[model samples]
Structures are given as C-alpha cells and as structure tokens.
Target: MTMATVRRISECFVKPLHDLSQEAKQPIYFSPFELLFLNANYSQKGLLFAKPTPTENQDFSISTFLDDLRGSLSATLDHFYPLAARLATRKQENPPSYVVYIDPENCQGVKFVHATVDATVEDIIASKDVHILVHSFFDLNNAINHDGHTLPLLSIQVTELTDGIFIGGSVNHLLADGTSFWHFMATWSEIFRSNERDGYSISRPPIFKKWVLEGSDPIINLPYTHEEQFIERFESPKVRERFFHFSSASVAKLKARANAECNTNKISSLQAVSAFIWKCVTRVRRQPNKSETICRLVVSNRSRVNPPMTENYFGNPIQSVSATTTVEELMVHGLGWAALKLHEAIKSHDDTAVKKLVESWLRNPIVYKLSGLFHPNLVHFGSSPRFDMYGCEFGLGKALAARSGFVNKADGKMTMYPGREGGGSMDVEVCLLPVYMMELERDEEFICALESN
Candidate 1:
C-alpha cells in the first residue's frame, strides 16, 4: 500500500479494447457488494483536511495548482468527448481512463490517488472538507471507477497544514456534480485569473449522447407499455421525512409560502424547499387512511432537458418528484384545496411527463423488483443553494463545504445537496431512519401557524 506518485495528471480515456461487440456487451453483475471493498492504507490521508497548504496569503499552490489542473487535464478531457459521444450505448462508453494505469483494482470502477497536510483544516469542515470520496467508495469498490471509458477516477490529497503545502490529483465524477464541481472550478479560476491561460485547448465538447436530453422517450430503450408495477405493498419502508431549518428569514418566508401554495406564480428556492419538504413528509408519514400517494421528490432534470446538460457530462441528472397536496392538503381542506393540489404537482414540467416517467420505470420490471422488495423509500432530492457553496475553488480555498453523494441505497436512501452554511442556508446529507432533524421542527410548527394566516 505504498503508491503515491500518481502523475498521470489527466486525459487518459480508454474505450478501444478493440471496441467490443456481440451486441455491444454490458450486463455484468457480480454483486455481494464486493464484500464492502476496502483496500486500506490511506497513510494518514485524513480524507480531506490539512493537506493542501497553498499560501502566498491564501494563494497556496496546491502543487502548482494541480500542475495547472494536470496541465489542463487533456484539454479538460477533450471537453468530455461531447459528453461521451452523446451518452454512448456504444462507442465504448465514450472514453476516459485516458492512459495513466497502475490500477491496483479496488473494485473495478478504478481511480484512487492521495496526499495531504492541511488547508486550514479544509476551511473548517464545509461539506466535510470534500468527502474524501466517501471513504474511498466505502472501501474501494471494483478498484473504484467513475465510468468515462475504462478506468479514471478518485484523486484527492488536499494538504496545506500551515504551509507544508501540497496538492494532488485524479478526479472524474464522470466530469462534475457538486454543482458541476464548482462549475469547473470556477471555469478554472476564470482561466486561472488569466495571464493568457496556459496548456489547454478543448474547444467545445459536451453532448454526452443520451440523445441530447433523452427523456423525450429514452431509457436505453424503455417501451414495454409504460412499465413498472410490482406492488407488494410497502416493505422495509422508513424514508418518509421532511426536515426544516428556516431562518434566513424563514427561507424567504418559505419562499412566499411555496408560491402561495403553488398557484405557480413560479417557484424556485427549489420549489419552495420542495414545498416545505413535501408538507413535512405529509405530516410525518401519512398514517390515518394512508395512500394519497404523493412522495417522489427528486429533481435534477438538468436544465429542463433539450440540449441543456452541458457543463461537462456526468451521470444521473435525476427525476422522481411528485409535489402538491394543496400546500399540504390544507390540513383538512380550506386554503383553496391546498393551493390547487399544490398546483398540479408543481406545474407538471412535462416532457411527455418526463418521457413517460422514464418509460414507466424502464417498463417496470417491477420497478427495481418491487423496490428491492419493499425497501421502498425513494424520496430523494438534492438542491444545494442551487450550487454555490462560497464558490467551490478546489485550489485549496473556497468550498469550505458543499455536500451530496450516493450508493448506500435502501433503509432510506437520500442525497440532497447544499446546506453547509454560506451555501446561504439549507443543508442535507441524510440516510435517515436515524431521525431527529428535530422531527422537522415539530411539523414546522403547524406550517408556521398556517403561514400566520
């Protein structure tokens, strides 16, 4: 476990193992969750805190600013090869492991590199100082891979512990997500505060194929008659919560009481914080005659599709959302049927109802086999002050914290973003069932006393 000099820097995309075919081979499932992986030896990496000591009065050269972002990481990986050739179902997953090798197989999704010291305790734990790749993908799965082509992922060694100054590399969360990884590190500090920007030239690249915003009717070909319906009646359920914090002026007074309970005068502060966490998870889990069926709540629809997802291709742009209940069924009918069923589920942003709900859950093969056999809990959402965490600078300054992650699924899997303060308010990380966000402020005090009427 002594590997460190990980200097492949970037641009290492591999898809041509003679471009395999036999109908484009993919189905490879060898689970047992790879016995929870763990290749050990972080060698005091501290995940991310005290190992990016770049100071010239806060201009600490996290190793020559990641060797100038790994020398413009292969022209920012040739602008994500037009989003892996428009989201390839072929063309060999559109290219990544751009030639850097030494894979030590941590599970197979390969990409791990480290180093450290301390960048002022990573600006004091903002987004837990950039989650050292969630314990290196919960102990290194398939040697860790963030799918670009073959292998290319994980490289976080942030150190600056009082000027022992060091900065490291290897990052490929498809390309970016954490608000487009601080919007490509603020477009590389606006061309590294430009002095005629050096070593990079990627002229336009981002279409990542999925038919350029697919959901008009695309899910690897989902058409089996509007699919998904295995209904075994709610099993391992538990993820029905709605937390609240409100006091940045009650989040602009609950975003004008969720746009006057969704009269749709337009809403965003993420649809009034997801209509106040979907009316406090329907008043803490709908029991009495339960089944009004309305808790989906996930939403990334990446700029409402159609040539929108640029900012360098990644994975799941998301969509589950359901929203509405007349600002929460006006607690037994009143304020105009709770603002018109919460304004027909937050103005039904229909792209053919988001492509027949992603082709009815990919033709509903029992929608994830009855949601992993009734472990149902899929109310996901992640907004994060719409990506702004003190401006994610990764050169070891800015991004004291901004959070979101995935892959721990079930027992209530959630992945909401934002809320590490100066994200300006609202924060979530939840895997919840460990409850107590103070039970969403005791049902947010009866909807802030019916919005002070």
Candidate 2:
C-alpha cells in the first residue's frame, strides 16, 4: 500500500485567552491513582476524525477551520484550566513521596500544528492497518513526553486532506484518563459548534477539586523509587498494530455463542468479544509447555464510587481487572469458559472492593507484574466501547471515524472503542509480534466471526 505524503503548513503555541485569577490558580495535587500514572508517565492516547460538514459554518469558508479550532480550544481551557498547567515536582521528606504540583503560572500554552496531506480519508481508512494512518496524519508526538515535568498537557494537529480534514490530539496521561479526556473533547466540540466563550451554558461542567479522592489517605511504602525498574526493556522481535471491526450483528453472534449452554448469567458484548480475542491470541502464541497467561481489562471507577462521582469529575479514576489461567486450560476450554472467567473478574470489584483496592495500593505501591515486553502470553485491554467517539460534533459534522494514539504499544496490548455509526458494534486495535499477528489473522474461526470491514 502506498502511504500518503504529509507536509507541515504551520506550527504555533496557543495560550488561554483569559487569565486565571488568584483564587482559580490554586495548585491541584495528585491522587494515589493519579500518582501511579504520573510516576509511570503514560503517553496520551488521541482520537482522529474527518472534518464535519453538516452544520452551516459562520462563513462557509475553508481557511477558518484551524483558526476556529484554536480559538475554541483556547476558550475551552478556561474551564479545564489544569490542562494548561505545569507539573512541578516539590521537595518532600516522605518515602515514595507524592507532592507533584500543577502550577498554573508556568502553563505557557499547548502546541497546535497545521498540516496538509495528499490523500483522502478513505484512502487510509480502507487499508489493512489503520495504525499507519493514525501515525502519519496525527503528528503531535513531540509535544507529549513520558516525563510529567512538561507543561501544557495537551497538543493538537489538524491535517488538511484532499477530501477532508483530520483533527488529532495528544494528551498527558497523568493529567486525565480516557473518561476525562473524552469529556474535554466533547466540551471542545460543543463550544466550537455553538461558539461559546465558557462552559457556563454547558450542562455538565467539569469539577476540578484536587482532593476529590481525599477520603483515602494517599501514601506508599515501597522499596523502589524509580519506576523504570518495574518496566522491562524494549528490544527486538518487532511488533505490529492491526485493527479489526466487529459489527453489531457480529458482536451479538459472539455473545450468543458464549451464552449458548450457560444457565447462570449471560455475558455482555465486551466480555464475549474480549474472550474470543483472548482465546484466539492465546491459542496462536502460547508456548506448548503449560504456563499461566493473563488478560488485563482496564476499568473506570467514576460510576463505581459509593456516591458516584459526577460525570465531569476530571482526573485518572481508572483501574484494571485481571484474569489469569494456565495456557492449557484457556485453550482447551470453549469460548463460554473464557468469557465466564472475564465476567467473574469484572464482578469481583464493586464500590467497596474498589475502595479497598485503592487503600491497598496506597500501602503496597503496586506495579504491573506482566511478563516481559515481547512475551506473547501477556495481553492488556484498553479503551472502551462505552466511550461515544462517533458522537463528537464540532459544528462541521460528527466524526467519520475515531482512533487511539497509544504510543509504545509494546506487544500484546489491545484497545477497543465504539465503532463509527454506532449501534452495538466495536473496533478493536491489536498490537502484537508480527508472527503471532499473522497466526491470528489466519485463524479461520476468528475471521468468520468478524463482520467484513
């Protein structure tokens, strides 16, 4: 497949047009969960979409797209003020300290890039690997760093294509999780669509109190201070990222197959799809000798909290639920068995369980214990079909498609998001070792179960 040529048109830093008053400039402290992300420094995942065109533009002119986005983003920052703040490290005497501060004065501004591409959206979306399209068109990688010291946690690149435009953004994971991130995007879209100055008229405005999770005394006692010690080295055995589309009907079929003989409870679409993928990948890549393989599902805690947090509470309120089983058992058993294991893992956590887990992590300083980077037996699931990516309407129109820019997707990591033209359909992005991915692609059963893309 031939690649599109992308040329940079312009680049500049955009600061909030309005200044934050002294009362509004109070520094926000990191929670235990937020500290976990801040210490590890996860790269911001992004979503890209073709320019909207249904609604009437102020002038129906082309050149104002970038200007409008920049202006709207600047205005949006007034409500989401922390995005424009600097993460400053403060001296602390405690071990495994957590005194990182988001200083507003050093925010500076976010970087905005405008580029032109010699291709259409379909040219890239129709390809076998959509990750290539994401990498090529959305180019704000340099703006996001693994270190939390960087300011202006968000950056956007708007690429003008022959047929349409692509609006891509990169954010610092320490600043927000997937829910918080999407909330910001939706707000930006609403502001751009309505030409609003602030979020006063918006129904669900963001809540930025730093001590929202203050109920739990956040502290950690660990032997290691350097987070790198927990991360395995990234070496050879090249990895590849591939995307698979499962239509609403296809997902229903998988769910039916999973619950065919079960008398207890029926599995959900996410559980069924996750199980099928897990089984396929494990069967293709697991070694002949028996060993325990694990599947980790990322979970959000906003709705799970005792007094459920408001939809607009912004920060990293995310956790993971893992299901581990021996390779022989996982492969020998049917899809229902695998799906049951996943459902059980998810059911293990509730409001009280989540609170206890948070408190436990405060004392233990837990790090991911998965196998080394290239180990095919370890897989992690991310993003969620629940996030309505296709609903984003930025005055132009709704997003044609959506994607994630999860930098350093080592191997055996997958992200699932709601399919465009949403029904119950889903899009799963998988990164794996080339050979294993080839085996998965060749799996006749897996291919037959998917809807033609």
Candidate 3:
C-alpha cells in the first residue's frame, strides 16, 4: 500500500555444531587459479524467497524459521567445512603467501544477520531498481571482508517481510567459484527440506583434494587490493544499474541473424547477446577511431580440466579470455563479425589449453591488473546459463527473483542468469555510467532487441 521499509534486527557468527578436530583437519593447497581470489575484490549475494503459509491462522513465525535455517546451515557446513575456515598466510618462507585450509582454531564461522522489512515479497520483486532492492535486502559492504590473515569467506542476511522471507548468501570469490557456491546453497536447502539431521547426504560430495592442481613451486608474495578507491569513485549516485531481459524468442532471432551473417560458423545465444550488447555499449561510448577496446569473457574450466573436476569441485575454476579490436574495427563490423571473434575465444580454451594456462600462472604468479572496476572500456561477464537460478528452491518455495547485490554496483559489468519464468530464457543485468546508459537506452537497435517483460 505504501513505500517499503527495511531495518536490521540482530547479527551473530554462526559456527558448526560439531568441531573439526586438529588431527582430522586438512589443508587444501591453493592452485594459482584459486589463489587469485585471495585478494579478489568481489563477493556474490543471492536471495531466495518464501511465501506465507496457506492457513487461516498465521502459525509460522520469523524466529522459528531462522532457527531452522541456522541449524540447517550448520549441518551443511559440516560437509562444506572449508567455508567456515580462514585464509591464513604461511609466513615461514621469505615472503608471506596464502594457504587454503580448515583447522579448528582458524575457523571463525559465517556471519548471520536478521532483518525485517515493511514490504511484501511481490513488491520487492516488482521494483525495477536493483540497487534499491540490494540495499533493502542486504548490507553489501559488510557481506564479505578480508582482514589480516583471517578472511570471513561468507556471510548471510535473512530478511523477513509481511508476506514472505528473503535469504541472502554472500561468498568471497577466493573461497569458491560461482558453480561451487551455488552447489553449497542448493545443498543447504536440501538438508532443510528433507529435515534429515542424521544420515544426511548430498548428491555430489565436494572434492577437497587440491594437491593435484597445485604446482611444484610457490611464487613470491605480491600485494593485492580489491581497488577500493577505484570502486568508491564510480559508486556515486550518478551511476545506474538496469536489467535488460532477453526473451527466448528474441535470443533465438539474434542467434539466427548472427549465424546467417557468418556462413562459416554458427554462434551461440551467449555470444550473440554479448556481441549485441558490446556493440551497443561501444556505440554509446562513441570512442575515438584510434582507441583500442577489449571484451573479457570468463570461461570456467570445470568441464575442461584434465580429468574434469567434479561438477561440485570446490574452488576457483575459471579464467578470463580477452578479445581486443580497434574502435574502427569494432564499430564497422557487423554483429556476426564480432560474434565470430567472441565465439573463437570461447572455443580456443579447451581442457588441455586450460591446463597449460594454470601451469603458466603457477610459474609466474601475479595478480591480474584488470578487474570489474579497474577499466571503463572493459566488460566482464558474470555467472553462466547453467547456474540453475530458478530451480534454487528452499523449503519456502522457488525465488520470485534473484540478482547479484554486488555486481550491479560496479561499472562496465554484465551478469547473465537463467530467467525465472523458465522456458530456457535468460536475464542480463548491466551496469554502466549514467551518461552511457542514456545513450544505450535510446539506441533503437539495442532497444528493439530487448523485451522488457
């Protein structure tokens, strides 16, 4: 009936009910890929919604729901024990370096926050502004942080509304990749749904073995920063984040058109959409003809690994592939031309190639200079079509909507997820400077390709 209001109630650290004894604990060595996240500046946040019970008497209460969730999370942690551990540095060497492991004393547990909002789940879902929704549902800054040797790798915020509840999980990028992170969330929901305390089981038990991928030598320590200053500058009120939905039919048409333009290759929906958006963004910027621009696509190697890491392998298993083209080439090229180049980059990194990439990084370990915030011309893709966003049903129900509370704040960032409405559709979340967004929203080509609903 009126504007919604949200307020925090309480917060506490949630630890596992059972302790991981020192003798039983093990340290999983960080592969060069996993170590990259140790100083990565971003965390992921996901919200799952629950509708009110369908009874005349409102028997359910927030306290009871939270208690159940907390217990279930603890149980899930026992299986995902590393999540509760800290990222401690090994200082005995010449320079300090990080080691990934879980020991009894180093585990600080995950932070759990309780909050309430004077809004209905439907209202929050209907709101168009992602920033408002994220701030209303989460305290983004405090969700994940690295302090000294102890890194609180994960934190969760649960918000209760008049008609429903929203669960937010924020995980450090270094601890797990998007696939592994969602796997943990799904397992937590399963444990709660089955109400299985004893003999609890998971479909895919996460493989914690890291030595196989860990190279022979560790490199010198390099200072890493999330570039907080760079992030703060663009996080001004002038920046805006907007959601652009691409219906299944719309994506099909784009793919068909792209394929038709290039007789030699057929493009994927992702490449088509990416090329389409990239052109629009570059057009909006209207950079000089002499300038060089690049598009970064994060490719996951879970399937491409030597033996193929389990779908549930728990660590960073992704690499960034970049394609650079001069402004003249990018602007003059047809969508198919751009799409073809993007497709080639994605295809080039097969399993053996990915293995070499990891080995190369191990040999000369260095922090990447580019990030989601470090450059304006660069665009980084987030999440994949297989994240199973819609199927992420907790005991309450399937989520009405789900989005990244963090990625939306950065400049030159784009995230793709499976549409909540199903039918193999996809949703794209784009963040850009206000001036560029103004141009993009007015571009007929971009506007015509997108379906608002």
Q: Judge candidate 3 against the unseen true structure and give its global Cα lDDT, from 0 to 1.
A: 0.71
What is the C-alpha lDDT profile of model 1 across 1-453, one tens digit per residue?
122222222322222112224332322211111101111111111122233433434565455655554444323433332222211122122331111111222223222232342233333343322333333212223222223234344433333333333333334433333444444444544444442233444233333333232433232321122112111222333332332333445566666666665455655555555444544544555434334434455455566555466545443355455543332343464332333444466467556666565455444422233234222222445434555544434344544333322332333333454444543355444444534334544565545833431
Error of 2 at 306 (Å): 1.6
Residues 76-183 of candidate 2: C-alpha lDDT, one tens digit per residue: 888877787777755434454435667777767777888887777787677686545567555444333335465457777777877677777777776787888888
Best by lDDT: 2
lDDT of 2: 0.72
- TM-score against truth, every candidate: 0.29, 0.88, 0.88
Candidate 3, 1-453: lDDT as tens digits = 576667889987777768776653755556667565544544565765766675833776678878888888888888887777766544433443434433436778887889888777667666665646566565445332233145466778898877777788777676677888888888888888878755587777887765255445433343323333122222323456777888888888888888888975469988988888888898888888878778878877877766777787787777888777987898888989989989998888887788787677666666543333355576667787668766657666678777677533456678888877766577888888888888888999998888533
Off by over 4 Å in 1: 1-109, 122-147, 153-248, 252-254, 257-269, 272-346, 350-352, 356-400, 403-416, 421-424, 427-453
In terms of lDDT, the poorest run of 10 residues in model 2 is: 366-375
